[model samples]
Target: MSESANDTAQPVTDWEGYSFDTRQVHAGEYPDRNTGLRVPPIAMSAGYVFDDFDDQVDRFAGRSIDPIYSRQGNPTNAVAEERLASLEGGTGSVAVSSGQAAISSALFALAQHGDHIVSTASIYGGTRILFGRSFKRFGIEFDYVWDADDDAEWERAIRPTTKAIFTETIPNPRNDVTDLRRIAEIAARYNLPVVVDNTVGTPALIRPFEHGADIVVHSTTKFLTGHGAAVGGAVVDGGRFDWAAAERAGRAYPLITAAPRPGLGSMLDRFGTGAYARAVREAVVNDIGPSLSPFNGFLLHQGMETLSLRMERHVDSSLSIAAWLEQQPEVESVDYAGLPSNALHGLALRDYDGRTGSVFGVAVRGGIDGARAFVNGLRVFSRMTGIGDTRSMVIHPLSSTHATFPQEINDRLGITPGLLRLSIGLEAVDDLKRDLRAGLDRVAALATPAVSLAG
Candidate 1:
């Protein structure tokens, strides 16, 4: 029998203490009291029942079970949040409308207008833009370090005003692994929270909190949904970092440290021990209005059921495809942890379950024109901008995803003009190989000289 979400039931683990496969299926689920249903049902009502004014008062005062508004919290979203948090070993989680919102809200929750943040150079392009353009406009400054793995670089960049160090577990396109343990040591010395976006690896492959990450964010819009049908994001609070320590150190986080406006309680007081995630919920998300809709939450819930199973297949197929692509004469290199030639292979072996994710890039011999020709000629793989779908996705990073970056930054990150990033999927490996072969053949066909008029 399963326990309720509110029940402090001790989690059960396997011989190795809770296998990743088991946790994916059972972590946040509970036996329903009303129906005794094994799976928690979606609560679609916009608001929950409030017995009286006293009940409402109690809930608003942080003393009750009554969830008043969907904006504040929904049963469906709470269930999904709880399950995901359990997977990451976080004390709590907050769901948002999209991945970008998760980042936006978390940053706001951590720092104030004048405070600074230090981040890795190569991350999701949109995140880079958010830090470079938008955050600067709002008076929040950011410093970018070339590699998160370089402890010396990280130490050198840290300043008194620095509030956080942000990076992805496995960076986009490049497939570089940030050495979490090493960076976390640096963050610890400076008393800064290390926030990591674990979207690419997902919880099945890596849990940054275990490696000393204070907070973890996810674009559940990706592998968490698996099918590419939903758009949502989540922020997991490891509850490991002591925000109280920062307060004791005499710094105030607007969301967590300061007293709430007149009537409302300070975020930490209202939310109790899970204040970090709750701050993102009640303050950043509420003010910004990026709540995940109930229907999308339901779609993500459906996707979560088979996450473990799908990830295994996704990893296996990706490894096979990457290995094959590396051998092709037209392909210059493959960036994936599963491949021995990959620069991050050793890191992946130690940190990942010896399994890297499906997203990686291949540099073609002919540069931009050849990449375009190859992608346009392909029939089986979709030339789409998104990733982590059930079907394979292919895109040229230089002309598409990372096109906005300066050439020097692109060169530094290895997003070359000829690079084609592939998000391998559940399709039969042979079929994918044949399609890739056809694409290369098309490039070859275009390069061949036409028969002479004399012939």
Candidate 2:
């Protein structure tokens, strides 16, 4: 789709000052190509018909023209991108193969061989692995600031080569609410872009851009997709950060210096509003080839139509279950900020209006054996690694998702042996409670006999 028509088709109300709920339903809906139908269709074509040779040359020369290939852009992907951009209050978006790919592309777009990234230690297990190991091979150094809550920690972690400050809105398993505004301030001081993973606290729950985040990324495969069917990710450029300003401040980002383009100027100079996003699309997404399938994009779009409704149920049911679990003796602690007793409750209340996401971790009194028994005993909640599915899911982070992290790192990140992470679904609350009770009962039974031995 050409930017000329699509950009002027419908002013994105959310991005263009529309309310959140209204934007969710009508953000990037293009009238049908053939029949002028309201819903945008999945364009499965691999290439587009150019008007002329000059237009083809213009397309290749970074002119604002329609897409040329499926790998670079598709109508289906464009709809998703528009919707995401609208929802995240961004200038534009790029859908990628996976969340890790989104993170990788976004980082590589701004940082290079000699550049560095300052990140919150509390983040997804896969993200941790990607930054700690994968990016290292490319000579891109990533340092973690353990105390993300401490502004001083983030300030100290920034190096002259640091190009971005990365953190999750609500870190998986940890469930700690990041102070986006504070982090944004810290990033502004250094003239670095703030990249936030808002997968958990989807836009329905929290909009990071409003708090000064320069860019937002999501594992659309999670809550945004609403179901566990697709594997995709999206990056949204808030269009707020002045990349040109960063460059003016002596920040030499890779896409500005290394990418091959003679008259195109630096990414910072060309795409004033979408410099980072355009860089990722042109350089990493085009060269590295992390494109989302059109079919997956269709599924993700369908999922988005009902996202707000699903999130409401997920949050309500999760809060109910988390509260019940807090009263259980078997549960040593519940790591849900919605619970008044949680250490992060105050922060969550302040930032998220007391909505602490559906995904949370519960610490059992007993250790690994107890955790395994509880997960296996659950009837309704599927024992899987993924979260934000329509159906409830349970997993032992220590033994599964966070297993890659060394024990010391895992512990430091608040993933302990007794903790079980749950992705609450839209199932009947009573039914979910019954299913959870069965698992907790089993843990209690096993723990009762084991306590005698300790005595």
Candidate 3:
């Protein structure tokens, strides 16, 4: 026998103790047994084979977690899920078709038709639309707390039927960072789990779980994918919430705590720390059928590999651009928390080290006309509705994202006519500044009065 026969070596599989940078690239990847493929290949099969009759029975009966169908789970999606979970410091995650699917699945797992959710006033406008339109039609109500710091406002918003507290780590457009710790404290008092949207503030910058969120959701289409080539989403379970205690306190999450069938145990008892994610996967995502494609799943995992690196460049460019815009005569104000002059700079410094993500707002001198001129003037920045992409993007939220909402609601949320949301990208900082100056020049032209030559 060869000397090597006496020793056996196994690949490093457990990534729990690895640093974020290392884990991002290696956490969910596994050696392909058949061909020793280093990269995780997209397993596109819709159905999985069972070992025997008993294996199929076990799978359908919930005895085995092996995927029976791709609608429920897939190997490719699993890689993205595990990688996202590892990065977000969660017990488990479920990849879905889109960010809206992730949010709906995540909340649907906890609340039923009659339940309510309290969210901070300043959130993604699309999310607000989802709540007002789809969620409202489903009989699930939402209340917005404008002043998160005011306990009275939270008290007024959160009712007895409230099942979850929803908030974003960094609210879109304005870049107003939520006080997650305060929200967590309020959630703890009511025995409600806090669900945070970390799409804007990716795990590379701020893991909401560390700040006390119980569930984290992401729009993988944005920063996590980096290239903006794929649209996907994921819901990660923080695994620290006390479900039993919450039930005792009169907040019951039936799907997680109740058995699907008489013979089967509750997801909480079966999956333990990963129960919430399991509930989201099996109960909501499986039932709703917003499954992520294997191709997108492959892209999501690959995109995460460079998440931290991209976020660093994104934040650096944003900081430089935001500071520059503040001094521009045509600019009205910059809504970046990283700026010392901003109201949320203290919170940004404490939680995010003053490196808030690249997406923020810049208001020009004139109102709607100024926004129109500024947007039409930009050459480098793509005028689009998406954020967190590798290419810089700009959108007039008042005209696009928040157009359907009432004027008072827009005013309350600070979606001003002159304000333009900017997503700084990986381009050279000087180039981005020059592009922005071009936009500001248009805004300045708007303020200039036309000469009356006839006079």
Candidate 4:
């Protein structure tokens, strides 16, 4: 006789032990107990129903981890948080309204008013602005290490007040990949946590924790969502950094390790290994009020199912496209580490299996005017200011994204007039190539004609 569906309880799946593709699908999903639904249903309600006054007390008092309010936590958002935590090999995760919030909240969770953060100079323009402008106004300081590979430079930048070391795994536009292992080594010596923005190098490409990152942040608006539909961000806690030890060693991360109330002890004392994430979700995110909607959470979760596949296609198309662009007569350079000609190709091969992600920079021969002709003439590649979408998109950083920066700062960061950032999509590689050729042809078409001296 055949076994019945409920005859025996199957062993629980070891999601962490599974491959990336597998974990992306099944990591945080659980069948509905009441309805036996295969997919986890989105809990749209703002607040969960309480059984009694005592039950409410337990939840509101932080004695229970269950959702009390949507802003703090939602059933749907919880699933996303769990899935992201699993994908990043983190112990916990906190979802926020946007990528910027993820960075702000994650950093604020560690660094306070008088604290400092050392970051790579080549980070996203918005992040740089937030650190230099908004965060600076709030009394938090940020220092940058321009040459990220220089281990001594990283060490020299650290001061007694430096609380954390930060950088993007693969800095946007410019493709100089940071040496995570080396930075982590320095952070370890100082008892400081290394926080990495893995937005571009999604877990599909690189898991920062494997290289010693203690916290991982993402703009779920990018590859995590796959489609250009949802906007969200996540902060994943690797649960390895000893915040208590850091505090004891003179690095003051009191935001998560100190008590704000007389009756309440430190998060580290109460939650142990889960303290960082606990503080992020309960204190920082709740206070900041940048909450991810349940709808976006559902959409983001849907996107993760295809992250592995979309990322693979993106890498393949991007590699071919970058190589082709390098040979173009109207092109100056292609800043894709995937190309063997790139200075960072060896790092790409060792780190990301020779794929540095679909986002890269292409400099056209005719400066700003040439770039305008190329982008405006293209049909297939959308002239949009976004990355990690299912449709190829392009943007000029100097005139748009990084236009506010000082000229010297722009030059240092490689946000040149002719440099165009490309976010290659799932479209046919040949189609993308042909569209790019048309753009280049337009640049040539608009060039000044040679003087007819022979005539």
Q: Name the best candidate (by lDDT).
A: 3
Q: Candidate 2 — which residues are off by over 4 angstroms?
A: 1-15, 149-152, 254-260, 450-455
By TM-score, the candidates rank as 3, 4, 2, 1
lDDT tens digits, residues 268-378, model 3? 999999999999998899899999999999999999999999999999999999999999999989999999999999999999999989999999988999999999999
lDDT (Cα atoms) of all candidates against the true structure: 0.83, 0.85, 0.94, 0.89
lDDT of 1 by residue, 189-300 (tens): 7778899999998988888999999999999999998898889999999987877776666555768756766766666766656888888887788777898988788777
Global local distance difference test of model 4: 0.89
Report the number of clashing residue pairs per model: 1, 1, 0, 0
**Of 1 and 4, the candidate ranking higher by lDDT:** 4
lDDT of 2 at 441: 88
Clashing pairs in 4: none
For residues 1-455, could you state the per-residue lDDT of candidate 4 as single tens digits? 98899996864445778877888888777768898877889888978899999999988777788778888998788778888999989999999999999999999888778888999899988898889899999899988999866878877889898988999998889877877988898899899999999999999899999999999999999999988899999999999998877878887777677885777777887888788999998889888799999899998988998998999999999999999999999999999988999888888889888989999999998899999999988999999888999999999999888988999999888888899999999999999999999999988876768678885
RMSD, model 2, all Cα superposed? 4.6
lDDT of 2 by residue, 1-455 (tens): 55786567663334367777767777777767588766677788988988999989988888763677777888888888998888888888999998888888888888878789999888888888888788998999988988766767876788888989999998888687788888888888889989999999999999999999988899999999988999999999998887666878988765754445677666666677877778778878988989999999988887888888999999999889999988988888888888888787888899988897998889887788779778888989998888999999988988887887787888787788889989999899999989988888889888574546554
What CA root-mean-square deviation does each model show from the true structure?
Answer: 3.8, 4.6, 1.2, 2.1
TM-scores of the candidates are 0.92, 0.93, 0.98, 0.95
Q: What TM value does model 1 have? A: 0.92
